[model samples]
Target: MATAIRRLLTAAVLLAAAAAAPARAGTLPPLVDVAWLEARLGDPALLILDVRGPLDGEDVVPFERAHIPGSVHTDYLKDGWRTTVEGVPFVLPPVDRLEVLLGDLGIDETRTVVVVPYGSTSTGFGTAARVYWTLRVLGHDAVTILDGGFLTWRADPARPVETGPSVPEPALFEAKPRLDWVVDTREVERALRDDAALLVDARPEDQYAGRTVKPGVQAAGHIPGALNLPESVFFVPGSGRLKPVRELAALVPGTVRGFAGPIITYCNTGHWAATLWFVMHELLGMEDVRLYDASMVGWAADPKRPVERAVPASG
Candidate 1:
């Protein structure tokens, strides 16, 4: 009881601080709307990163053409943020490599970094979430995603944009790893039997049901007892923004209510699952959310691990 009360008090204090100073943002909550970002445009401590690029085509041409003023572009796909380890795709890179990557982009301990996705689709937005997760894992807490990303910024005529290259003055980046935010394949296996932890499959129903799959993953379906909640449901179709809170609350129904247990989110390679983790942990302020970085690619590769698909029961 004492521990519960202490946690509640800590959360209350955080809420109070968030309300008191909105400008000192980007740490606890991992999202910021365009309006908030527009107001803080010229702050010296702000680092805007445009992570817009195709997986395999073009340089930073799209980002070079026009971007938020003073914003630098990093190709999230090609960059070493996610790497292959012994044949697994989209796994987090080594800590030393990540520190240098962020340092080269002029990111440091003091800067409030806001990652901007292209915002074309829910899948596109996952890039921003992955980057946000990486920063948090590296122990840089002052990072958030531009909620609507570059599309919403471009929609408003008053928002200023700049073209051409931006050469950021590199800063030293140090990594203080937060091991709690991540869960490996072994931990996930344990969570399968632990009722206190909920295993959420963030892939679409087709993939979840073993009807379809993306390339490079060995599995056909999902882990046993995992619930399917596709990432697309979180975003509004035409608006290029997340649905309002009331609407978002209705989508998952009783799934999250009164459940203070840990949520472990995963997809084929941890890409799509990042979106669900962002919504549950960052947007909704759920305290215990962890991403399974190896995801199904790792889970399914081993024949000893169990996998499941939906099947009709006998009438």
Candidate 2:
């Protein structure tokens, strides 16, 4: 073969290989039952992470003093997964920095991470969902939330508990940003106007209405015509689990009626948004759900957008 022809053939082979390979899409692992996790506790590929933090200024370390054995401690607050960009709260760190941090935490491409938050459910436990969001956006396909979080783990006396940190060998996990997992202000603005997508605001009634909002929001109300199912509703105190799937299915607006358009879940700074996304993507089995990582912090920063809230939304 001619030299030029040989080079062309090589280039074609490379192109074909690239096209034929799987696109490396992310996977949303289900919320595991206690039995499921207990069964998998001894799996070599699994790592349990505790994401509990101080509640109402109480020291979190004390709680960690008695926690599930074989669990690694990770503080979503002080560990520096976020930074303040123009005062938008807790923005995700750059991919390179995140990759290093995950490695230090003993998480890697091959690990199946299970994160447990401070609470059994969503009472001030948005941090767990936030960390879950971080893992998902970083192209991890094997992350699961410990069903009902730490509270459930605590309730069962037989479940093993230990004090302090559990360390592991530093790992080498490479995280490529999956931008599709997240939506930005532009996409949100379009979702607000578009007839297809649903924009679910996970903020409280006060924030949703014009009563009170966190600082720096452009306007006091919700995105022009967004649905309001504040994150709190999803947390059922009785079960320690998220609301029953049937209850949630009926509660979630767009899912029941065959309206499976894209969902963009958002809250003040994306923390609560993660909870909403978790409920939809994991519990309710809603498809094509995405998070606005910047969330209201980015949306409300702009003057062009309109916030409108009048009626209280219910099931």
Candidate 3:
């Protein structure tokens, strides 16, 4: 009972902090625009994580040069947040490892984490979504993604940017895995047999059609019976912003009805699929969504698994 009460009190305090944040009216959503983030730059409960890519395994010079004030830098590519298991790349690390990682970054259950990416393209934005998904899978509910990310932040010269490393006092991070949000190869195979879930392919059209293939996977085609909604469709190129919810929903296939049904999203290594999961669950408010974390790499590892490519009508 004491633990329950403490949790309730912590929740209340976080809620009050959010309510008092300088954000624009209507409250913050899972995706916050630059304007919204700019307004809440000093909220004590807010933690901005700038996950810029470390090109060619080099140092994070871009983050070292400038970042949002009070933000911390973590190289998404270099970080062990995603790892390989049995040759499958980009799989989530174990719970203890994630706890140490998040704790070292000064994250805790009480804080509201806003993941920031470079926002150069869908690929960059996917970094934010993948991190956001990781936090969610670890049961961190008070997380959001910075729409337009650091690119949008820098576009506004007036917004303050800071240089030099900012060391934060570490916090105790507790990992509470939400297994329902994750699925594996066996579960996906069962879903295919039972027709119990809508499988959404987050790969590009050519990839989904097996015309283009990514390395590290045995098969080029997508899982049989999956719907195609390439992750790139969610972003406007060169704009650094995701499409509005109405626009995103319009892109959904007409065959799929209702947001409550189970939907499993997958890409080559779960990187792209994280973007789709964020769009459907976080932005669209869809429920019963899960990510195939192993994605195509794991699915295609076995020779027995089936892959299907939609053949364009012969011209």
lDDT order, best first, reads: 3, 1, 2
Which residues of candidate 1, in runs, are more than 4 Å off? 1-29, 55-61, 194-196, 238-240, 311-315
TM-score order of candidates, top first: 1, 3, 2
Error of 1 at 209 (Å): 0.1
* lDDT of each residue in 52-160, candidate 2, tens digit only: 7763135334554787778888767788777776666667877888888889889998888988875644644677777877887888868887777776777799988
In angstroms, the error of model 1 at 301 is: 1.3
Please give, for residues 1-315, the per-residue lDDT of candidate 1 as tens digits. Answer: 998995685556445434433332434356778988988999999999888778313332387788899998887877698898787778998899999999999999989898998777777688888898899888888988888888889888888999898788899999999878898888988877666588888998899989997787787888888888888898898443677654554555346533678889999889889988877776655668899999999899898899898832422
Best by lDDT: 3
Q: What would the per-residue lDDT of candidate 3 be over residues 251-290, giving only the tens digit for each residue?
A: 6554542434589999998988998888777765555789
Per the 3 Å backbone cut-off, how many clashing residue pairs does candidate 1 have? Answer: 0
Give the better candidate number (2 or 3) by lDDT: 3
Q: Higher TM-score: candidate 1 or 2?
A: 1
Better of 1 and 3 by lDDT: 3
lDDT of 2 at 267: 82
